[model samples]
Target chain A: MSRPVRVSPQELRQTLIEAIVEVAPDVDPTTIDPCEDLAEQLALDSVDMLATLVSVNERTGIEIPERDYPKLATLDDAVAYLVHAAVRQVDAAARQEEDSSI
Target chain B: MPSLGADMESGTLLEWRVKPGDVVKRGDIVAVVDTSKAEIEVEIFQDGTVEQLLVAEGTRVPVGTVLATLQTTSDESERAQAPSAPPPPTEGPSAERPRVSPVARRAAERLGVDITSLHGSGPNGAITLADVQGTAGSTQAARAVKPDEAPAPSVAADRQAAMRQAIGALMARSKKEIPHYYLQSTIDLSGALEWLGKANETRPMSERLLPAALLLSATAKAAKEAPAMNGFWRSDAFQPAEHVHLGVAVSLRGGGLVAPAIRDADRKSVDELMASLNDLVRRARVGVLRSSEMFDPTITVTNLGDLGAEVVHGVIYPPQVALVGFGAVGERPWAHSGMLGVRPLVTVTLAGDHRVSDGAEGSRVLALGGRYRQRPEEREK
Candidate 1:
């Protein structure tokens, strides 16, 4: 209903890492491999993964459907997915705004 | 510091959330304590106004030491009548003296061991029960205390070692004392999974339930039905609990495990259990669980499904009489209504204390759990 907040891939990646650290403080951001499965590498359980995802959604205001959770297994894939979702949201918001003005 | 676990001998007081003159009720978190396994928020167990804090922050003290003094609300009338009762000494005469644990002091008094003449081998040169007992056993008790041990290792590595020690000690005690018997049953979970999938279709991502929630709730409900498996073995006797508090064994991110309770699990719905389970796991991982959560579990449930374990025969935490373990739910050949077919199944195991319960009670618990789990739709309420 409003303008979607656009985020660059690097910023989205940083946001994901921050969210993870917020939930599991023992996680060292420096040790994370961007291409590796985040949960398995960090030994995070499903609840931790869900909390991290929820924190990310709270920070970015992105409505990540549950079906898309598997696509976010790795940091690189998560950033790419979020970046594309942000662009689509922005486009949809712009079209809606234009229609309302008419 | 109150005992956070069976093996927690002492804890370092990290910070006080409340100060003198603050009013605290039962279950209010008053301080944070750093144990070997995790940093836990210590809760007050009575309604009172804080009068004085005996232990300073950053000081490590043994369990049962008086950390703070409180003015109970119930004693108002007594205080009013005896206004001159010497204000209950703020500090004892032995304050600022030897750093001896309460248990060690008692042992010293009983065994006629001179505590002041000996060096402590415990953390920060604090005397422990072992130090006193060893001294009483032999003439030589002056072990060199290592106050300035080599600069401490990384916190994570140090914690890992300490956690392993704590778990090993408790497990050894369990194995040596309790006669444990294990029973395993494979439950057909096709109905529950099907019900859960349909239920999730109408909910949001955050509210969607996991299979573990169903397993936990079912175990809780089953324990309520099978009372023999729902209590503790204390004081050389079996004492059944009034309500079902299921201790959820959560594995930490780095290592170690803590089983904190979800109070009154049998009364909660599946959705409610899921929410509590999510919150409990989150808090347990963050190392901020409350004191009662650590102490109030009547029974424990360990789920190793995520790790792909087929079955778990958990060691019963001391005092508690039973442990329920749920393994991975996978497709397997099964006979349903006399027809052979492939179905989703889970292996549930029960480890019961032979001193308190026999195999019949353990079987009843597993059977009831399976029944509850089979009817996921009915439990949603």
Candidate 2:
């Protein structure tokens, strides 16, 4: 299967906030800054984060590994990881196509 | 609405899932309540804007008490502000209000009631869980049930479901865990009928001895002779029952069963036993059986004779080491005084838990029925 491209930093933060909003709509998004640690600040447990992750995956095409979850607790973390990962995938696909062309 | 739990009478407003002025749809979980059964997320009954959250996180309110207001506009928060409401209904914390806003902050400074759940008529939904906690007695109305649901917290509903769940878990665990041994015996019941008939002629219908009334009488007599077969098993210790509480298993037409005990079954006579049995059966049918009635069974007596069944090998009700299954009786042959004779007979089955007793102990208890020569004489004995 073709790997999906990474989401933008803004989009990633929006995704996380949307998950929280779905669970707690009364909460103000401004209070839940993506740069801040979700666990320390929002008191998000691993289970809560898993729910958010599930919600995010449902909306996106990313295939994040379970092992990679610790790297994406914050919005900046998710964006940086997704962007770098997407670039590598795109480069690998382009190289494969070139070899096939030859 | 689906209930969060059976034991959840009320919950602490840990935090509002939605804030004032936020829009929500049906099925939206609007807040979290700390139910004794579980920490449940209270869902929106319908779609609307959150006008104000009446109770804050950590602030307690009984179940069905409005934690927040949902209206087409912000004006709907007033519905919860009614003067007639029950006051400061919080969960987890039984006595004090929740700790949320500044007064709650000062109080939280002193650990007062939390009120972050309170939506500010002050604007911007800034009233913290602390603020609501500070304004004690103002939130007293919050403790009350809504106008629509008279008893916001149906303790009975909680109790019944809790009782069922508890009964469910226990029976499930027991059937899976305990090794049961069942034994049955048929006795000449002709004497029981004639004895009861003569006794009823001298007494009123309200006090007349019925078959179960007689069986319970004999059961107590039997239990006293065989005390080892009564009571429960605990870790490293076995507790033998002192009082003779007779558990009469009443089968509801709906198909499940409950046993409401006749307390001090040994103390009552045939007439008194019948009256108590009638009251217990009535309460058991309605699911309003009390703790003592539902529990406190030193032994259980389940009658299947009414259903026209001849014999039944019953399951031992847990904790109590023995169960006596009563079945239909018919006239049968018996060798009496070295001669063959036909006599009315009834069969009693004893299901005992082997962990607490042996087959010999169960057999010994059943033999005590033979000691009571007359059914009427049992009442006086």
Candidate 3:
């Protein structure tokens, strides 16, 4: 079986920024404050947010549920959430691989 | 029979929402049609029973082709007998025989005016161009215009290809047919932005306004002042639209773009327009749009600000005579009181049909838009 891909926190943050920029082309990633609300700072509407989520999912192969979108209100929060989610996904896949081997 | 838009020669009947023998009320969505732009839900105007389905699904027919037969309570016999001859082919129904000239009929159809509501003033009680225009203006004032797709994770490549072809055809037709005259002006949006910022402070994040809402409202008001710039140029003539159904160009995440109408934009407040625009952009991305919204735009508005463009010279979406474009709103050196200072400026461009209006009228429209932006409070009024 192939080994699972590894993603670091900083890498995840960059991916998140790219995703946000892809969704809203007008937003400048360098100008975004990590702690500021992305919706207010970037003027991201619900549709824009949805597109961002889709972009993140496509990039990281992690599906974030709509209910948990509020947790990703800021850049830092999104990065942290995505990193944790990615780790958990890799761990779950490893466990399944072990179980199948047994 | 619905003429989805001026460019649409025909639409494919994708599915029938209502089956025969089903009871349907006015404003009920009876069928779904796949137009050149998008799949649209078509609504029926008369309350009736579905007598028969004349045209089956998957049939691509021209505009004004009768799709189904309806048995109405008022004229049950006549309608039931004359199933072949459906009411005059237009978006809305004109139940009775309204005395309207051929030109007037075409004008009413293009303007989304209900002929039955108009009072005829011509000889033999016939409705003329003036009569239609008068009724359209008054009807707009009298009527208080009160006004989602499944998660497809993977973008459909075929849909994108189809949309690209459709857009190419439409743009080609536009360039070939319309004599377009372009005019642009840079407006200082400092006042508008300041007012918007202050106004947004009290509102919730969900209800907060975007600069697009302000632009749309301003364009609608400007169109109201310069009526010649708002309407369809069809049948070798120009028909002015009384109400401003502003078509907003929304880019899809996958590929291509669709500009659906926000019906009666001048009548709606900025906040209301924001809500409508949000809904439109969301649905447009998801590929679920109503028939009326697809076809009803009197003029089109495209904002390339998001793309960071300084100016956009857009092609006129036929039969719409004008297309208003708003480009990047950024800080620029300005002279307000003979003093140089940095202010937020937006380059607004108007691409008008030279057949119907000239640069002078287009300039007036842009000036009106700038004036409206200067006084943001007037947007809601």
Candidate 4:
């Protein structure tokens, strides 16, 4: 139950678009795509993008502090972040399990 | 950017609020358009001096095109017109409060310390301490008590919850966000009712005068008498009003409250007042009210007397400082010509905003009640 599993690529695409629409209602949602950068396509500035980050944090509760925001430039970046954190958690849990068995 | 989308897509240039060179704020309406929707007004969402009108009013362009560019006043904003620049999220205060962030909305949650329901000047209407402290109320309701321990809330516990919630939202702003105080007096409603009874005898059912209409008259007169009560409270300052919008709080049947204001109540006649009061009540219950109906109420009056309430001292709805609450004008024994007699009486509670006037000044403004000297009685508990 604790092992990391791949987050579905399809789910990642859907949630990212959902997060953008929730963050920026005025932007035409039909034009939004996961691959399209928010700043270049939807005209989101630093503050508007911060609001989007807040929505993500509120939904996922992954404390992606502001300093790490530069790493999240595209939709794949978000998926990678989630997967990498899950792998770390699972690796720590496996070590604990191996110690218990020994 | 000052963008004018023509109404007919090609209607003639009707007029402009400012000539090409005039300065305008972000939301100021720049030009009126003759559009397919009708002669529509076009507004600018950027602050800059208008350099030119891009197209003559009669030119027809597809809806998706640019109306006008505000001219390169700042290099920072030249990019704003381009979707690529990411229009700096100004987040100027929207009149209708929007959904707030769960975390930034702490002032309201602090209970009696913040008012999130008011038009906030903060980021996206985030509840601010000043707004809460001004009203002196919070989203916090009174502590729960056992049924055996304390009296029930005046309205239903659940509906009271909604009522309190709505009241909490509305009052959070008026009490905390706006500077308010009250000025009250007892009206000798005895003569007015007598006059109203005679007026009712001659008039048709639809035209009869209720006490509310007369109360409306006095309030309008008093507000006009003291224009200071008509304005809104801005940050750390008070702006006396130019319009006298009167809000009357109508109690709903199943237990909720609605205060719908009659616009320009000062200029309206008794018959017009009666009609508007009727309309405000009907639409208020069904929830079909137009947003304009709630926007600018310079003064508000709340009457709980009809619900067996002796008197209700009102909370000022922020910005506007005074609220007059009407109590039952019941039949009570009184002295007429120094002899004991029965008469109908009305008690009015005036809640004032000290930001503008003090208790002494409030009493003077309340002198409108003096004209109604025939009120049945004056007794306070």
* Cα lDDT of model 3 by residue, B1-381, tens digit: 588765567787766777767789988888878765666779887888887776666678878877888888775722423334323222232233444543444456655788777777543355555556566656765532111111121223444555677788889999999999999999998999888878866754456677788888999888878889888887999999999999998876435778899999988899889889877875554345788787779999998775668999999998889999989888999999999999999999999999998998888889989999778886555
Per-model CA lDDT versus the true structure: 0.78, 0.58, 0.74, 0.54
Q: Which digits, one per residue and each the tens of the lDDT, describe model 4 over residues B254-373? A: 345556578898788766877887666544432224323444678888766654567788888755678878876678777779898877877787787777777776776677545533
Candidate 1 ranges beyond 4 A from true positions = A1-4, A98-102, B76-154, B337-342
DockQ, all models: 0.19, 0.01, 0.04, 0.01
Quote the positional error of residue B178 for candidate 3 in Å: 1.5
Candidate ranking (DockQ, best to worst): 1, 3, 4, 2
| Least accurate 10 contiguous residues by lDDT in model 1 chain A | A1-10
TM-score of each: 0.80, 0.46, 0.66, 0.45
For TM-score, the strongest prediction is 1
Q: Pick the candidate with the highest lDDT.
A: 1
TM-score of chain A of each: 0.93, 0.69, 0.92, 0.63
What does DockQ come to for candidate 1? 0.19
| Model 1: residue B305 alpha-carbon error in angstroms | 1.5
What is the lDDT, from 0 to 100, of the residue B359 in candidate 3?
Answer: 94
**lDDT accuracy of residue B245 in candidate 2:** 86
Model 3's CAPRI class is incorrect
True contacts kept of each: 0.36, 0.00, 0.04, 0.00
